[model samples]
Target: MADLRDVAMDSKAWPFQEARALAKRYEKAPPEKGHVLFETGYGPSGLPHIGTFGEVLRTTMIRRAFELISDIPTRLICFSDDLDGMRKVPDNVPDQAMLRENLQRPLTSVPDPFGEFESFGHHNNAMLRRFLDTFGFEYEFISATEFYASGRFDETLREAARKYDDVMKIMLASLREERQQTYSCFLPIHPETGRVLYVPMKEVNAEDGTITFDDEDGREWTLPVTGGHVKLQWKPDFGARWAALGVDFEMYGKDHSTNTPIYDGICEVLGGRAPHHFTYELFLDETGQKISKSKGNGLTIDEWLTYASTESLSYFMYQKPKTAKRLHFDVIPKAVDEYHQQIRGFKGQEPVQQLANPAWHIHGGQVPESDLVVPFSMLLNLASVAGAEDKATLWGFIRRYAPDATPKSHPGLDAAVGHAVRYYNDRVKPHKTYRMPDVSERAAMEEVLAALDEWQGEADAEALQNMLYAIGKEHRFDPLRHWFQALYEVLLGASEGPRFGGFIALYGIEETKALIVKALRGDLAHEEPIDI
Candidate 1:
C-alpha cells in the first residue's frame, strides 16, 4: 500500500491533516511514490493487552487510508522492545524479576524465563504479532536485540546523536520529570547478563569491517556481529533510533504520553522538527478492569481472533481515537456483519482520505486494492453458494462471489467457504431451531411449518422475515430470535443456523421442514452445523 506523502495536496482532514503538517515540518516532504512510515508497538512480555492492537491498528488504518488516496508506499515497523528486563510479576510469570537489580535496562527487557515462548521477550513479542497478524497487518518487525547487534543503525545512532547534540540534549532534558535515570545519558546494559554492552572502541579506528562488543560479565562475551542485537539507551537512543530509521508515524497509549511529557517534544527533536502525528487516549475493558499484562488481566490479539475477523478489528480501530471503549468479544461477529453491510452501502469501500499537509505527506492514503477487502462481495457470494444446495452449486457461487476470500482449487476452500457462510448467516439472518418436546411450541412450530409446507415456490426474502416474525409474535416468543434458535436446533440439529427465511429460500422450504421434523425426531444429531 502507498504511504502518506503521495496525497499531501489532496486534502486536509483530521488524520491526514495532522499527518501532513508533521511531515512538512520535519522536512520530510511527502512523495509521489511516498516514503515508508514506521509504526511501532511492543509485545506484552507476559500477556498482551488490547493496547498493542489499539496502538498499531490505528496507525495501520491511517497508512491504509493514505495509500487509498495516493500512489505512495506505506510500511509499518513494529519494535518489540522485548530486551528490557522484566519489571513486574504476572500470573503467568511466577518467577518475575522483582529486584531493581534484576530489572535490566530498557534496551534489554523481557518476562519470566519459564514462559511460553523460547525467550520471555520472544513470548511477549509473539503475542503482539498474533494480534496484528490476526488483522493481517503488515509491518517490518524488529527486535531490540537484532537492532543493536546487527549494527545496521549503530553508526547512524552515533552520527544522529553526535550531529544533533544540542537538540538531543533538549529532548532528553524535556523528559527529566518522568525520566527514571538521573544520569541524563546512560550506557546500554545487557538484559540477560546485566552489564554494560559495548563494542571495542579500540577497534573502531580501523576502516576495515572490524568490531568487538562484550561485557566482563561471564555470558556477556562478544559474538561475531552475526548481528543479533542493538545496543542503545532509552533516552536519546530512542530518539536517535527514530531519526536514523525515518519513522514517520507511530502512536503510544495515553498513559505513556501522560506520564512522558517529553515524547512529542523529543520526537520533534529527533526528526529535526516534529513527528508526522500522535493520537492518544486511555484504555477500555470488555467487562471490567483496564487490561494489564503485569496483572495477567489483559486479553491478547490472538484472543480476539478466536471470535472476530481482521476487518472487524480494523473497523474497531477506525472509531474515534481520543475516546476509550471496551471491545467486548461478543459484539465482534455482529460488528463484522455490520461492517460488511456498510461496504455494500458504499457500493464497495470507503474512498481513501489524502494527506492535506504537503510537508509530511510521506505516503499516500489508500490501501492497495489488493489489501483492501470488499466485505459485501464476500457475503453476497457466500449466500448464493450456500443457497444453491449442492456442493457444485455452492462451489460455483463461492468461486464467483469471493474469489479472493478463498481459493476454489485449494483443499481448504470448502472449510474457508463454510466459515464465510457461517459468518453471513450469523450476521444477517440468525435463526435457531429447537426440538418440540411439549406440543405448544410443537403445534405452533408445526403450524408455521405447515404454512410453509403447504405453499412456497419462490423464496421471498422480506416476506419470510415478516412471516417468521409474525409466527414468533403470535406464539408469544421473544421476537423471531428465540423461535429461530429452536427451529435451528430442530432443523439443523444445532443451537442455530442462518435466518429461516434465507435458509428456506436457499435450500427450499420443504427441505427445511423435513430437516426440522427429522431433527425433532432424533434422526439428525449426526449432522454438523453447515450453511443451509
Candidate 2:
C-alpha cells in the first residue's frame, strides 16, 4: 500500500495538482510569514451568490489538499471589499431610493436597506458570513473597512503611494485613451460628502503619503493615503491587497483572468510576491448568460439548498472547476444523485483512487458511507407518479423498498425524499406535458399491463426490467429507449424518468399496475395535455 501523502503528491486530481504547485512555492523553505495563506475575495456591491460561495469552496479544497501533501500550517481568509463605493443599487434589494441616495459613497457608509446591520456593506458581509457559516467553513473574515481604519494596511498603502507612478504605468496601459486621461491609482473620499472621487490626482506626495484631488464641486483637498482616507482603484487594490496580506494562493473566475498581469505587477511593485492564481471558468444560466449577483438571474445558494443537500452543491463545485457549468434548478437532481453515487463508490476504491474521488475532497478525506439506496432522480419519478406531497408520503414507498432502513438510520435518503417532494412540487409539476401514446407506444404499454398481470413472486427490479425489455423487444421498440420514453411520457408525464423496473419495485407491483391502468385509460393528470 502506498502512503497517502505520496499518493496525494502524485494524484492527478485538480485540487492536488493545484496544491502541488502551491507546495512547490515553498519547497526549499516554508513561507516566512510562518504559514501559507489562501484568500478568496468578495465584492459586497450586492448579495453574495453561488459563484461567490464557489470561490471559497474551491480555495478550501486546494487548502485541504495542501495540508495532505505538506506539514506546513495553512490559513484561509474570506476578504470582503466593503470599502468599495456603491456604483449602482442592486435591483434585487429593497429601498432603492435609499441606495440611490447613497450611490458613490463607500458601501460601509451607505444605509442598510434591509435595516439588519450597521450599513449596506455590513448587511451583505453578514450575509456572506452567514452563508460560509452555514457550511461550517473554517475561515478568517476580514473587512477592508476595518483593515484600513485599524492601520493594518498603513504600510502597504504608504508603499503604494511611494510607487504611485509605477502603479499608474501598469494601470494606464490597460485603459482606453479616454479612460486613461482621468484614471488614477488612488480614489479619494470627499471629506464633506464621504463619496469616493474618481477624479485625476493633482499631486501625489509620497513623502507625506497624501494625494491632492479636486472634488466634483472643484474644491481641492489632500488626504493621507493611510487611515482609510483614500483607497486604490479596483485593479490596483487587487494586487495591493495581496501584498498587504502576503496571500500565497487565491482563485477567481475567468472574468478576472485578463487582469492577472496587472494584479501581479502591482503586487510586485509594492514589494510583495504575487500569489499563485487559479482561474476557473464562470457559471452560466439556463439561457447561457453569465450568472450575476446583481441581476439575480441564476439559481441562488438558498434556492439550491431548498431542493438539494449542501454536500451535493459542494460536489457540483468540486467537479471540473476549469469548465463552465450551467447552474440551474434542472441541474440539482443530477448533482444530488451523482454525489451519492460517488460516496457509494468510495469504499471500494483503492487508496489512490479514493484520493482521486470527489467525495474524499468534498468531505476533507473523511467521506461518509452513503445510505441512499434509492437515487434522488428515482425518488422524483416516484414523487411525480404518486403525487407525493410530503416526505411521509414518499417514506411509505421507501420503507417498502428498503425494509430495514429508517429515517434515523438512513437520514440522507430521508432528506433526499423531502428534497424530491419539494422538487416535484416546484420544478417537475409545473411544466409536465403528457401525451396520448401513439399506436405503437399504446400497444407496448398494453403488453406491459398484461405482463404485470402475469408477474408473480417478489417484485425484483432486475427481473421486472428484463420482462419490460422482452416486451419492448416483442413490440419492436428498436432502440429500447423508445419503450422507456413511452412509459415515462404516458405514465410519469415527463419526457424522461427513472428506470421503470426500479420505480415499480419501490412503488409496489399492485400500485404500478394501477398506474398503468390509469395511463392506459388516459386518466393520468398533467399540467397540460398534448397529443403525439
Candidate 3:
C-alpha cells in the first residue's frame, strides 16, 4: 500500500481543488463535523453496479470524517434522479423493450419490465442500498419523485430563476446559437375531458420573479415560459433541485463531469445554491466495446461485493475519479485485502511498514489502503497453487484441512476466497484445460511424485517445499519448480495452478495424493461447473 504521504506527493489535487473552489464560490467556510449538511447524489441506473457505491460510500466516508473533526452535524442523503428520462437501458436490466417504448416519458414512470419489484429505477436503487448497508454505511436515500413532490425543490427553482435569469438567458442564447438547445412554451389546451391540459398558476409574476404554478387542472403542471416554455428542463431541473436541497457535496462520474457545469449554472439561476464540493469518478469497463454481464462485468455492485469489501469499494471512490482507470474484476480482491491491511496499520492493529506509503485515518476507520495491492499475502496463495486443483477444489481442500476452527479465520479470508474463486473461474476449464502432463510425461511426473512421497509427514511448509524442488531437479525439471508441475499434472491434470506448497499443507497429504491420482487416470471430464 502507498503511504498517505507518498500518495499525496504523487497525487493530483485537481479534484480537491475543484471541491474547495466550489465551496469558496459559494462563500461557505470549510465544513465542520456535526454541523455541516452533506448531500450526495446518484443516478438510478437500476441494479447499481459497483461504481454506484464507489460514488456514495466515499462521500459518506468523507462526511463522517468531517463530522468527527468538529461539532458540525452531518447527514448522508443519496438523491436518486429517477425523474430523468431513460438514456439507455443497461444491458443487465430486463425490459430492453421499455428503453425504446419509454422514449419521452420520465424514467420513474417506466414500469419495471422484469417482475422483480417496483419501477426499474427503484430496483436498482435497492441493490445499491444493499451493497452500502453491507459495508455499514448509513445513508438516507431520497428519490427524485418524492423530493420534487414534497416541495423541497420549489424554492430553489423559483429563486434560482429569479436570481440568475440574466446569466442563464445569455448562456441559453449562446447554446441555441451553437445549435445545441431547444426551448418550448406550455399552451394549456383542454384535453378530451374539457379540463385544461395544464392548470395555470394560481398567481404568477414573470416580470417580478414571482411565478406560481399550482394544480388547477386536477393534475400537477409545471409553469410555462417566455417566447418559449421555461419550466426547468430535464438536466437543469436537477441543478435547481440540488440548489434547493442545499447539497453541500456531491460526486459524479467522468461521463457526467463534462456537462455538470451546465447543472451548476442552472442551479445558480434558480436561486438554490449548487453543491460546493464534488468528486468526478472515472469509468468502469467503458473501454471495452463489449462488457461482460454474465461474469458480473460492467456496473454490477453485487459482482464487486463478491470480490471486494465495502471499504475497499469505498477506497476505489476516494482515488481521483478519472476517466482513465479500469477497475477490472481481476484486480479487485487484492485491492480489498490491501484495504484490510491499511485498516490494520492505520489503527495500530498491525506493525508499521518498513517503508513509507500513503494511508490515513478518519472517523476511526483508516482510509482504505493504496490502490496497488503490491505482493500481498492472500494473493501469494493463488500465485502459489501448482496446478493441484481448480480454485474451487483448492478452496474446498483448504476448508476441509485447515478449517476456520478458531474463533476467527485468517485476516484475509474473504479476499482469499474471492481470489481463489476468480482464479478458478478464469483459468480452470473443464475441457481443453492446461493439464499437468500425460503418461507420456510420466518420467518427469514420477520424479516429482517421488519427492512428494519422501516429503510425507514433513509438516513444515518450507521444508516440504525444498524437498519437492530437490526431487524435480533430479528429473530434469527446474528444481525450483520441480514438484509444482508434477503435482498439477497428477492432481489437476493441469501444468499450473494456485500455490502448491500451501495446498499440500492446507489440504493434507492424503487429499493431495487422491487428487493427483484422479488427474493421472483422466477420470475427471469436462463440464462447466457451478460456483460452490
Q: What's the lDDT for all of these models?
A: 0.52, 0.91, 0.51
**Among all candidates shown, the one with the greatest lDDT:** 2
Specify the poorest-scoring 10-residue window by lDDT in model 3: 182-191
Model 1 off-target regions past 4 Å?
1-36, 47-50, 68-75, 93-118, 126-138, 146-240, 243-246, 268-271, 280-283, 295-299, 306-309, 342-413, 416-447, 458-460, 469-499, 503-532
Q: Report each candidate's C-alpha RMSD, comma-separated, in the order given.
A: 9.1, 2.2, 7.5
Per-residue alpha-carbon lDDT of model 1 for 397-491, expressed as tens digits? 44443466444344334533444555435443343233444555676667777778776555565577678888888888866577777765555
- Which of the two candidates, 1 or 3, achieves a greater TM-score against the reference? 3
User: On residues 1-532, what C-alpha lDDT tens digit does candidate 3 reach at each position?
Assistant: 2353344233233332343343344345544332345666666654565666666655664554343333345677877776555655666665678666764334555677776757766776676677778877777888876665566655554464455445455346536554333231122222232222223334444545443444443554444332112334556656766666666677665666666777777666655556754546455474653233223466466556555555556555555554445766655655655555555566443322311212342223344433222223333333333332334444554455455522134434535455545544543433324253555356655554555566645455566566566555665564455456556544554555445665566656655555545455454433222122
The candidate, 1 or 2, that scores higher on TM-score is 2
In the range 174-226, model 2's lDDT, one tens digit per residue, is: 99999999999898888889998899999999999999988888888989999
Model 2's TM-score against the true structure: 0.98
Best by TM-score: 2
* Model 2 regions lying over 4 Å from their true place: 525-532
Better of 2 and 3 by TM-score: 2
